[model samples]
Target: MSPSKQGKSQLIDSLYQKAKKLHWKQCEQCRVKKNLFKFVR
Candidate 1:
Protein backbone atom coordinates (compact mmCIF):
# COMPACT_ATOMS: atom_id res chain seq x y z
CA MET A 1 0.00 0.00 0.00
CA SER A 2 2.91 2.36 0.68
CA PRO A 3 5.32 3.58 -1.99
CA SER A 4 8.31 1.97 -0.29
CA LYS A 5 6.58 -1.37 -0.08
CA GLN A 6 5.59 -1.20 -3.72
CA GLY A 7 9.20 -0.47 -4.71
CA LYS A 8 10.47 -3.37 -2.69
CA SER A 9 7.94 -5.73 -4.25
CA GLN A 10 8.97 -4.65 -7.71
CA LEU A 11 12.65 -5.15 -6.91
CA ILE A 12 11.99 -8.61 -5.58
CA ASP A 13 9.93 -9.56 -8.63
CA SER A 14 12.74 -8.40 -10.91
CA LEU A 15 15.29 -10.42 -9.03
CA TYR A 16 13.09 -13.51 -9.19
CA GLN A 17 12.70 -13.19 -12.93
CA LYS A 18 16.45 -12.84 -13.34
CA ALA A 19 17.06 -15.90 -11.23
CA LYS A 20 14.57 -17.94 -13.25
CA LYS A 21 16.28 -16.93 -16.46
CA LEU A 22 19.69 -17.88 -15.13
CA HIS A 23 18.41 -21.24 -13.95
CA TRP A 24 16.98 -22.05 -17.37
CA LYS A 25 20.18 -20.96 -19.03
CA GLN A 26 22.19 -23.26 -16.84
CA CYS A 27 19.85 -26.14 -17.56
CA GLU A 28 20.24 -25.60 -21.26
CA GLN A 29 24.01 -25.57 -20.96
CA CYS A 30 23.94 -28.81 -19.05
CA ARG A 31 21.79 -30.45 -21.69
CA VAL A 32 24.17 -29.33 -24.39
CA LYS A 33 27.12 -30.70 -22.52
CA LYS A 34 25.40 -33.98 -21.99
CA ASN A 35 24.63 -34.30 -25.68
CA LEU A 36 28.19 -33.47 -26.61
CA PHE A 37 29.49 -36.10 -24.29
CA LYS A 38 27.11 -38.68 -25.69
CA PHE A 39 28.18 -37.89 -29.21
CA VAL A 40 31.84 -38.13 -28.35
CA ARG A 41 31.40 -41.47 -26.68
Candidate 2:
Protein backbone atom coordinates (compact mmCIF):
# COMPACT_ATOMS: atom_id res chain seq x y z
CA MET A 1 0.00 0.00 0.00
CA SER A 2 1.02 3.58 -0.54
CA PRO A 3 2.26 5.72 2.33
CA SER A 4 -0.88 7.78 2.43
CA LYS A 5 -3.10 4.74 2.60
CA GLN A 6 -1.02 3.22 5.34
CA GLY A 7 -1.08 6.42 7.37
CA LYS A 8 -4.85 6.73 7.06
CA SER A 9 -5.44 3.18 8.16
CA GLN A 10 -3.09 3.60 11.07
CA LEU A 11 -4.90 6.74 12.11
CA ILE A 12 -8.22 4.95 11.94
CA ASP A 13 -6.82 2.03 13.90
CA SER A 14 -5.60 4.33 16.65
CA LEU A 15 -8.92 6.12 16.75
CA TYR A 16 -10.70 2.80 17.00
CA GLN A 17 -8.49 1.69 19.83
CA LYS A 18 -9.10 4.92 21.70
CA ALA A 19 -12.85 4.60 21.22
CA LYS A 20 -12.74 1.03 22.45
CA LYS A 21 -10.75 2.06 25.48
CA LEU A 22 -13.32 4.72 26.24
CA HIS A 23 -16.19 2.24 25.76
CA TRP A 24 -17.93 4.29 23.10
CA LYS A 25 -21.01 2.83 21.41
CA GLN A 26 -20.87 1.58 17.83
CA CYS A 27 -22.87 4.51 16.52
CA GLU A 28 -20.57 6.96 18.25
CA GLN A 29 -17.60 5.20 16.75
CA CYS A 30 -19.19 5.41 13.30
CA ARG A 31 -19.80 9.10 13.74
CA VAL A 32 -16.26 9.70 14.85
CA LYS A 33 -14.97 7.73 11.89
CA LYS A 34 -17.14 9.75 9.53
CA ASN A 35 -15.85 12.99 10.98
CA LEU A 36 -12.32 11.74 10.68
CA PHE A 37 -12.94 10.85 7.03
CA LYS A 38 -14.18 14.35 6.34
CA PHE A 39 -11.18 15.84 8.07
CA VAL A 40 -8.84 13.60 6.13
CA ARG A 41 -10.45 14.55 2.83
Candidate 3:
Protein backbone atom coordinates (compact mmCIF):
# COMPACT_ATOMS: atom_id res chain seq x y z
CA MET A 1 0.00 0.00 0.00
CA SER A 2 1.06 3.56 -0.46
CA PRO A 3 2.51 5.41 2.57
CA SER A 4 -0.40 7.84 2.72
CA LYS A 5 -2.98 5.07 2.55
CA GLN A 6 -1.21 3.11 5.25
CA GLY A 7 -1.11 6.17 7.49
CA LYS A 8 -4.82 6.80 7.02
CA SER A 9 -5.70 3.17 7.75
CA GLN A 10 -3.63 3.27 10.90
CA LEU A 11 -5.30 6.46 12.02
CA ILE A 12 -8.77 4.96 11.48
CA ASP A 13 -7.83 1.82 13.36
CA SER A 14 -6.52 3.85 16.28
CA LEU A 15 -9.70 5.90 16.40
CA TYR A 16 -11.82 2.75 16.43
CA GLN A 17 -9.84 1.35 19.33
CA LYS A 18 -10.20 4.55 21.31
CA ALA A 19 -13.93 4.61 20.67
CA LYS A 20 -14.24 1.03 21.87
CA LYS A 21 -12.62 2.04 25.15
CA LEU A 22 -15.19 4.70 25.94
CA HIS A 23 -18.45 4.09 27.82
CA TRP A 24 -21.27 3.76 25.30
CA LYS A 25 -23.43 6.59 26.57
CA GLN A 26 -20.49 8.92 27.07
CA CYS A 27 -19.23 8.30 23.57
CA GLU A 28 -22.49 8.31 21.62
CA GLN A 29 -22.89 12.03 20.98
CA CYS A 30 -19.20 12.71 20.48
CA ARG A 31 -18.88 9.84 18.07
CA VAL A 32 -21.82 11.11 16.01
CA LYS A 33 -20.38 14.61 15.91
CA LYS A 34 -16.96 13.33 14.95
CA ASN A 35 -18.38 11.17 12.17
CA LEU A 36 -20.41 14.10 10.88
CA PHE A 37 -17.32 16.29 10.73
CA LYS A 38 -15.34 13.53 9.09
CA PHE A 39 -17.99 13.05 6.45
CA VAL A 40 -18.34 16.77 5.86
CA ARG A 41 -14.63 17.30 5.47
Candidate 4:
Protein backbone atom coordinates (compact mmCIF):
# COMPACT_ATOMS: atom_id res chain seq x y z
CA MET A 1 0.00 0.00 0.00
CA SER A 2 1.05 3.61 -0.57
CA PRO A 3 2.26 5.70 2.39
CA SER A 4 -0.88 7.84 2.62
CA LYS A 5 -3.16 4.86 2.22
CA GLN A 6 -1.34 2.93 4.95
CA GLY A 7 -1.66 5.85 7.33
CA LYS A 8 -5.36 6.14 6.59
CA SER A 9 -5.87 2.47 7.33
CA GLN A 10 -4.07 2.73 10.65
CA LEU A 11 -6.23 5.65 11.68
CA ILE A 12 -9.33 3.79 10.67
CA ASP A 13 -8.28 0.79 12.77
CA SER A 14 -7.85 2.91 15.88
CA LEU A 15 -11.21 4.56 15.30
CA TYR A 16 -12.84 1.17 14.93
CA GLN A 17 -11.37 -0.02 18.20
CA LYS A 18 -12.61 3.04 20.00
CA ALA A 19 -16.05 2.65 18.51
CA LYS A 20 -16.17 -0.97 19.58
CA LYS A 21 -15.49 0.01 23.18
CA LEU A 22 -18.24 2.58 23.07
CA HIS A 23 -20.64 -0.01 21.64
CA TRP A 24 -20.04 -2.41 24.51
CA LYS A 25 -20.46 0.32 27.08
CA GLN A 26 -23.73 1.42 25.56
CA CYS A 27 -25.06 -2.12 25.50
CA GLU A 28 -24.22 -2.60 29.17
CA GLN A 29 -25.98 0.62 30.09
CA CYS A 30 -29.05 -0.39 28.12
CA ARG A 31 -29.25 -3.94 29.40
CA VAL A 32 -32.30 -3.17 31.52
CA LYS A 33 -34.29 -2.23 28.40
CA LYS A 34 -35.62 -4.81 25.96
CA ASN A 35 -34.75 -2.85 22.81
CA LEU A 36 -31.17 -2.10 21.83
CA PHE A 37 -30.15 0.70 19.47
CA LYS A 38 -27.44 0.28 16.88
CA PHE A 39 -24.50 2.60 16.70
CA VAL A 40 -23.53 1.47 13.22
CA ARG A 41 -25.84 0.85 10.28
Per-candidate TM-scores read 0.85, 0.56, 0.54, 0.70
User: In candidate 1, how many Å is residue 17 off?
Assistant: 0.6
lDDT of 4 by residue, 1-41 (tens): 89999999999999999999999998878873534444332
Per-residue C-alpha lDDT of model 2 across residues 1-41, encoded as one tens digit per residue = 99999999999999999988777677788999999999999
Writing each residue's lDDT as its tens digit, candidate 3 over 1-41 gives: 99999999999999998887776767888899999999999
Candidate 2: where are CA atoms >4 Å away? Answer: 24-41
Evaluate model 3: give its TM-score: 0.54
How much is 24 displaced in model 2, in angstroms?
A: 7.2
The ten-residue window of minimal lDDT in model 4 covers 32-41
Ranking according to TM-score, highest score first? 1, 4, 2, 3
State the C-alpha lDDT per candidate.
1.00, 0.92, 0.90, 0.83
Q: List the residue pairs that clash in candidate 1.
A: none
Per-residue alpha-carbon lDDT of candidate 1 for residues 1-41, written as tens digits (9 for 90 to 100): 99999999999999999999999999999999999999999
How high a TM-score does candidate 1 get? 0.85
Best by lDDT: 1
Ranking by lDDT: 1, 2, 3, 4
* RMSD (Å) per prediction: 0.8, 14.2, 12.4, 8.4
Model 4 TM-score relative to the real fold: 0.70
